[model samples]
Target: MTIKPLVIALGLITGSVVLSACNSTNDNKTPITDTQNLAAQHSDAKPVVYQVFTRLFGNTNSNNIPWGTKEQNGVGKFADFTPKALSEIKAMGVSHVWYTGVLHHALVGDYTEYGIVLDDPDVVKGRAGSPYAVKDYYNVNPDLAVNPANRLAEFEALIARTHEAGMKVVIDIVPNHVARNYQSLSAPQGISDFGANDDTSVTYARDNNFYYVTGEDFSVPSSQDYQVLGGEPHPLADGQFTESPAKWTGNGARAAQPHIHDWYETVKVNYGVKPDGSYDFATLPAQYAQLDYRAHYAFWQDKKLPDSWYKFRDITYYWLDKGVDGFRYDMAEMVPVEFWSFLNASIKMKNPDAFLLAEVYNPTLYRAYIEQGKMDYLYDKVGLYDSLKALMQGKGTAQQVLDVHASVKDIAPHMLHFLENHDEQRIASPEFAGDANKGKPAMVVSHLLSQSPTLLYFAQSVGEDGSEMAGFGKPSRTSIFDYIGVPAHQAWMNQGKFDGALLSEEQKALRAYYQKLMNMASFSAIAQGELVSTPVTTRSGQSATNVIGFGRQSESQRLVVISNFDADAPQTVSVTLPAGWQGNAIDRLEQHGQVALNNNQLTVTLAPLASAVFELEN
Candidate 1:
């Protein structure tokens, strides 16, 4: 058996928030040896935190609260997510909880004094959705307030509750765009600074202005894509485009203007330009009544957003002082990298150990965001892309998966790795899981990627069935055509199965085996083991291309993880265990899969889409 390693809980100092952790006992009696030597080698070592989705102002459903909403339905009192949500997350042994969509909703005007209107589809999916597109930067969504407390008190209390739960809270930030319901645009109160645009230059800001649907210059008649909010008509270079009122699925996203609804909804901020290299907004307005008309939106060369443009910088210490652990940046790529570098430093100045996770979608290369250390950890797309590809096509060797992992390791936090998130399709589906008949290869690779931290989305542990209606921008419903079919929650109930699920009676046993494996390893160096690639037997065909093997070792812990990408047959793999690897090693994911050193020669049989985690027995 491997010796138990020492625990150093005070290493992460970027914005170090104290973690109150419970004793982590194994679920079953699987006395795995300690693997502490592994932690010293991981230069990118940090804590692994789990994230949960909570809806903002839209979802009022008492039982079904969408991911980003802050309020509960059929209830007048504010949604109390503090101790309630953190307590449940802590119960699962997770040290951190990422609470999404708790910010103030600047979307709706004071129709309800809270500024969040339930009528907008963008805010709520079919009247209940996760909050992504934001409107205001300050204040808490009134639905998140239990008492008549200010934004500061609510946030401070939330952080304190999280700390008290023996955990940390990672709030979401959207630097890309805000719901265009501009409290900032309203003259005395609104922020009308779009770069260099002037009051006379409103015509240059036509992209954000409104127009009539059939207004003479508008070409398309009834298509739902072209949106025209009510206000003033905007003239584009090609022709005048008008707005559509019903584009929003449920409520709205700057869907309607002051003339239409009592509540102010969301608006669409320009991403700076149209794709065609042409500036949509220019200094021109249509002559109303053959005389003169007002320009739609004033054009501003506001490419560089001022600090006061958004409340991101202003609200940093507010929550930090309240004792929130950190901020996991949402869409870090959307904003300039320079901005985050400054923010992360500023946050560190206040409290080190403030973790920063950037949501760089499908960024496997890691060159741009991860290497810079603009934030602590960025998303890993290697496993998600290649694993899904291998599972669906039943092609490629395990080497492909390893290559991606190695690449992901370079540019990203060595500790960072994730499979499924709230934004993507569930891993429990056929596309990434292969067929229901045999076990899914992607699922195994997800868990078997050495001891690196793997993120588990809320429904991922239980199982989230496929969605025909699920969309990246808009969350869709499950298609009746799919095998999982309707009745909704039933698919999730069977633990992600149409009929032939990925986890077999044998695989179910393996799942328990790995949970114990993770619990034991987390206490030692295995959580942050150093990654090193094993020499390839053949560098050529499916056999040559398919198998990918790598070993993660520290002073005490040595583990070899082999994942087969080919679906048809077992890939032949010969991985030699590295030297000085004296420790008790076992396959963390597979109970029977293990390799002992006979002059460091080990031959492993890896099934297609399956991965095995090996531990070194000293």
Candidate 2:
């Protein structure tokens, strides 16, 4: 039932604020569901997210040559997401499976054998291609399917099986840009491609799908000492693409040939925002903040929208029909917030529980993006993730972490936390901590810090040192650009048994620790509890600067978490708990029974880079 815009305006004229149909938290209280309480016996856990780079997650090949082709290093397929693998992932305390790089992106692989159009090598990033450079919004990546013609069907089967394993699915939606060779062979009937209806003669237009450099041909930038596929000879790698009117680069570059530092593989999408940053779209009323998606949808029903906005709207609706539960929007801040309000509202009207996560980094715009854009969550990279990374690197202090919590306490639930992702340096890489065990304390803090969802990359559990320089550019982090198999993760895969039978004892122990912590975090208290910071001091009155402590409590339960961040020494730290909370502490991670908490305080010794979760007794 669509409410007319006229009726909405009349209602708005009478009432200053629209009411929310869903529960809007003061952003403080975290509520646990009965389902979570049932899982609490094993470990009261929050939402543990397992993010798999779809192309690389199931690859078991070990030939990690730089600039390797698919045949050389192997690619994971949708067929590899077997029922056994999904069950194992579910058993690892994962509530959601984020399938990254599922869409049809620009890649060097030939799919013409399946009648799919080929992307030009000059515009593609690497042999595997950048997932951000989307080529077709409506089709699944043929690289991920055993039979390229059945790509979408394979993905749909994966989605159904994921649900059968009691986990939700998340896929990326690269709304900010598309590859220079964007073409949608599988788009629904009557749907036009991006830039198909644009006025190419103008540099900027309110209705144009992209910003263009009028009367100019697109040229490859010569600034960087780079070549397509590291100068490997190919007929299509002749430093030429065929865009007659060159559009602006994805990263807002206005040059005919974008700088090497710019996002040259893709072209930016234009919302109604002009070059001067003036908006041409209708503004949402301030009263819309407290409104539910239905109200927001009703408010925008009769209004006219720009062509790009409608194109994206169609793209999202198409995915929703494919059994996708949510989207992790790429570079969402680049699109106008007004467009998001319309798009998200439309989506929520169709499926109100749809998860809408945005990659917005600017702290100042966080509130606006959540309230105005209706995003369910935003990456907490600039807050908790960055702080813990610095602390892990031994250049930051534990106090800075507390300061970060204080800064975002009001919006904590909406901040998604992670130590590693496709764009960030791996925790085991030299550029970062250079040790996978260092992630223990940081992961403890990230999961126990708030009621927010926690994310982990595929190999983070098994300690894949991200040193595979597989291609495209200088490599320190795991190569998302090239064909490479994560050695540690492949060991766990164990040639499709989906067991850690081949892992070293240390690797197996690391996986066990992750499972314990992640399952413990699933507890009701941690999932829905309020955080209270505890002072870290010892019985001898020595302040433990290398230790951090905090408590999570619900109406029925309480738990205290403490971690030692020092790299080489064990520390005995005393934590000052809240009044009236004294009990026998059971170590959730190490499984130590009955460490007493006397007189509102608990003192425990922790190994270097170790973390302990203490379940409090009455």
Candidate 3:
């Protein structure tokens, strides 16, 4: 099948969009497809929004939230937020609610002192580490399960309640590796070697698929690709931050440790082994191999895991019974396409409308997930990343934004958008949040022109100010490696920790404004409208990067957004309109003066580190 055109695409080849002093304007261009109308229609399409993750609602915690109990911070399903939290997100006009870590075991918890993950041997201790790394695919950790007393039915009830509340629950599914204490590989009949698993009941041939490597060429990736020479062996393995595991270590890919490696009980699956890169999906009861992996995947992939690990198509009765609206596969990169076909095909067959959000990142790896009808919308990381950077850097002009829209309109009208996720650094990573206006535009622009199915991380909504404490290796940001910024910069995070935000007052107002825009998009034509642009002229430089202005127009309504990208510059510029557009433009924000747009052209004045929006004649 040929590829579908994108709903929002990158015109990156139009050359890089850098904030500049001035550039020539193109007023004669009309894009091939009328995105303006489509965007208007799309605004009515609700965004399938999901949360980051929370692991405190485990069986042992109070209220037994599954990942954590009410007593244990009660934030159990962070992404699965409480009624109050749900209301907050719903207020934002969002759809899907993803209570991230709603699946089975794998000891979770990292003993975080705020943003900093303490040195626990295994890293999955009780301070709420990411819920992605699974411990047991079948067994839903009692803590997060709806009711530990009755795992099966309770789990069903949770799903039912989520549906009743008008939201679909999405869980995390990892096909890479199982818990280190995986009962299948540690049994007596097991050879303590390949081919024989802990279950001892099934041989390696029948146990499912995984690759095991015996030697070390193990290179751990800790820093950015450009900065780091190569992936290095973690000097801090499990929990021993002091000692590095050198030479060829024992055969345990990842294992269960005491205080050291307590949190995660996983063994990373080897994607490189079984050379020639062959992965058997051979046929029948071996269509069964694919089937088994699917069954395992379904368990931890939602907020409410099923009581038992059952086959995929067969699981439909439970899904309808549970009232689930979708499934978002985790770590989809490692799963083979042939195997994934059944997943998407089966779900659509079961309910035709089940939304599938696969965690496949790379284009080559996620192609099948996107094109095969396997997923309604796969997460587009680079696309989201680029759009976010463009706005934050104050470079995505009206031309830049529309050029992007023209490109991706058909590829997938609805794609998942994001800034920071559980796996990456919180946007507050000092390296990125270098702004005094508190980085509000970063958050605002993301949700504003983003594709549908947007993802908002834990601290993103509130502009939670701070940095990542579980920063995988770099003990410090500098040579001395001391906790200087944490205590002083983030007093709220009294520890040597930082908040996950940097939103300014204007940025906050902008965020509220865009949020309204998002809601308008949800029920209006903004999302599906045909996109058109109006250009604004401004000088850009180190202090003037903040000066940006542009207009996005839909058939029924035409709106203009303008802002100063630079935090330090004070300046003004002239803006031009589309060929047929005309009107007395009104500034959405209080501005000093107004410009008369004549024959589709208008000269306007702007302030430093400030923005304004104008509404044109409908």
What stretches of model 3 exceed 4 Å from their correct place? Answer: 1-43, 56-82, 108-129, 145-147, 150-161, 183-207, 213-274, 282-321, 364-368, 390-412, 434-438, 468-517, 539-551, 586-596, 602-613
- Judge candidate 2 at residue 388 and give its lDDT: 91
> What's the lDDT for residue 315 in model 2?
88
- 1 or 2, greater by TM-score: 2
lDDT of 2 by residue, 1-618 (tens): 000111000000111222222222223442211122223322345677788999998898999988899999999998898999999898878888999999999999888888777778788878999888998999988989988888999999999999999888989988777999889889999999999989898988888989899999999877457878888988888888888899988877888898766788888788876776667778888767666667778888898878888898898898889888888988776777778888988987777767778898767667667767788778998877888988999988888877776676666777889998887888888888888999999999888778778898898998888888888766556777889988999999999898899999999999998887777656777777778767889657877667778888888888888998998998888899889888688887775556897798898888899888888876
Scored by TM-score, the top model is 2
lDDT of 1 by residue, 165-222 (tens): 8777777766544543323211224434322132222322333322121212212223
Residue-level lDDT of model 3, residues 1-618, one tens digit each, is: 001122211110111112122132221132212223224424466464656343421111222222221343233332233454445456556667665665544333331332222332233322233345444343344444444535445656666655656666666555444444333211123123222232222212223233333232223323232111112233334323221221111122221221121222244333222223343333112222223224424532442311111233343334444566776676554444544544555565566556667765554433334433245566666555565556565555434543443344444444566765654444545554544243444443444443355676544443433432322223212100111122112221222122213444544554465356446445232354333444556544222234445555555666566665555555676666777778777765445445567778665665554555566755
After TM-score superposition, what is the CA distance of residue 137 in candidate 2 from its true location, in Å?
A: 0.4
Error of 2 at 2 (Å): 40
Q: In model 1, where is the ten-residue run with the lowest total lDDT?
A: 288-297
Better of 1 and 2 by lDDT: 2
Q: Go through the candidates in order and give the clash count of each.
A: 70, 7, 101
